[model samples]
Target: MTMEVQFEKSFYPISSWNQGSQPYLASILFCQGRRTTSLSDIDLFAHFCAAAVPNLAMVESVDDEKIANRLDRVVASIGRKPLRVLVQVNTSGEESKSGVDPSGCVELAKHVKLGCPNLEFSGLMTIGMLDYTSTPENFKTLSRCRTEVCQALGITEEQCELSMGMSADFELAIEMGSTNVRIGSTIFGPREYPKKEAN
Candidate 1:
């Protein structure tokens, strides 16, 4: 059996890589799709990939209130294929964000455990703060959340992967015990932001 692991909320760049490398590869499909990702969307995506490639490993993203029902429904629909979920915690506490607060991630993780027994609650996922200087603190906050979640769930720290790093601040994340890092710029160069027109 092929074991696959994925980095969460990788944006389009990471998704692009997974699209190219399927079957026995860990593919991360973000929740920020055409609209908010629903259970049906997850079903379609997972089913499509599993059909095309038998050995594919998939980790779907979930945030806040949608975490419970969405995960439950998806796992039931997809059947057993080593499904894992990325619990996105909005460490920045932005209004437009979808994840639970870092302070409350343990409660969220507990809900995930109780509600979606079929899916494996492999780890916690957070998008590092945009401001590089503040990224380390954000990672620490996520670390605290992961600790609480592990304690609540009675899972060993070794079994839990606190996915708290990204293209930015990957080294700090490593220092803080981030098992996975979503590296884009390092591999693909700087992202091209939309150019503002001349005033």
Candidate 2:
């Protein structure tokens, strides 16, 4: 199997390619909803081509405080140069969820842009709280949250990228003005269950 296929098999969706010692491109390779593991170095920039290929990367399970901390680190390491950073906010009102309060993300964005002049504050990314059955309330909550976050960051609606839909709610998200929709099950079919550990 090709490296791309191997990546797909091991991580399901996250894709990265390295040609020789140069990094080619890095896009969001995989997403496991709200709670997800952080990407590896290869996933971040090992084989990335920022100019040729879109090196899209996202923060896993983001919160205002965490965003602030990460922004500080990025600024320190990369210095004050505009860097594209996609902030993923998980807006599930459950303890098991992986994001911060939607409104709170605005504060995080502001801090990144103002405090970390190096980061361009590209847009907002989010996964709706998982619900067995879809509801208007679910979409409504995500829509409202997106709007609030954009407002907090003082970003124009056109500039704000709303990433709040997946295979289950892609249509809903599009209808609700989702800029990016992550499709998984639709393209790959249902996933197999991994072995579970006993308590």
Candidate 3:
């Protein structure tokens, strides 16, 4: 099976790609569509690729050429099949977010398109500011990146998905043309972050 998950209209993706997520993939595959963003663990990336779900996932935290190139090599060695990827854009301009800046987005996307043969330059994704709803500015920034990438790559806007929004702002995101939204929390409840230990 190819990494065939498509971020089609109203795509609802689960947000869990940790080591513990493997067993659940069997059941999750029954959904019409599924995706996992915030895939930040570079080390686990190769491990997942070599596992069972490699053909059913997309990496969304790819901000630089280094990470994209690394994925290319990993996929090349694993099965030489094309893996889908979304160029993460730091539209909020927050230092803590893991994504490419608005200015360099097109350049990085170009690398993914022409440079990474084992990868499919699928679309663009972003995390809005944690404290706020999906701001039009953030949506606009990602939309602009998508437009630029489509124009530069000779692809249509529809072909380049805009994976913005979450459960909190999915309606607004869909209104603003977000093809994909992460809504796992809405179904499963808020995440339980581990408590920090005292020093």
Number of clashes recorded per candidate: 1, 9, 1
In the order shown, the candidates' Cα RMSDs to the true structure are: 10.0, 10.4, 9.7
- Could you give candidate 2's per-residue lDDT for residues 1-199 as a string of tens digits? 0012233325433333222222112223343222224323233222111111222233323346555566556555754444555555655666666555665667776776677654566566666667725434555665676577677777776665555566666555555565555554544456667989999
Best by lDDT: 3
lDDT of model 3, residue 38: 39
TM-score of 3: 0.72
lDDT of each residue in 103-176, candidate 3, tens digit only: 99999999999999998988888889997644778998999999899999999986787777666776667667
Spell out the clash pairs found in candidate 1: 24-55
Q: In model 2, where do residues sit more than 4 Å from their true spots?
A: 1-61, 75-81, 132-135, 196-199
- Candidate 1 C-alpha error for residue 156, in Å: 0.8
lDDT tens digits, residues 76-138, model 1? 777765456657788777776557777777877777777777566767777755667678777
Worst 10 residues of 1 by lDDT: 46-55
Of candidate 3, the 10-residue stretch with the lowest lDDT total is 20-29
Model 2 accuracy (lDDT, Cα): 0.50
Full-model lDDT for every candidate: 0.56, 0.50, 0.66
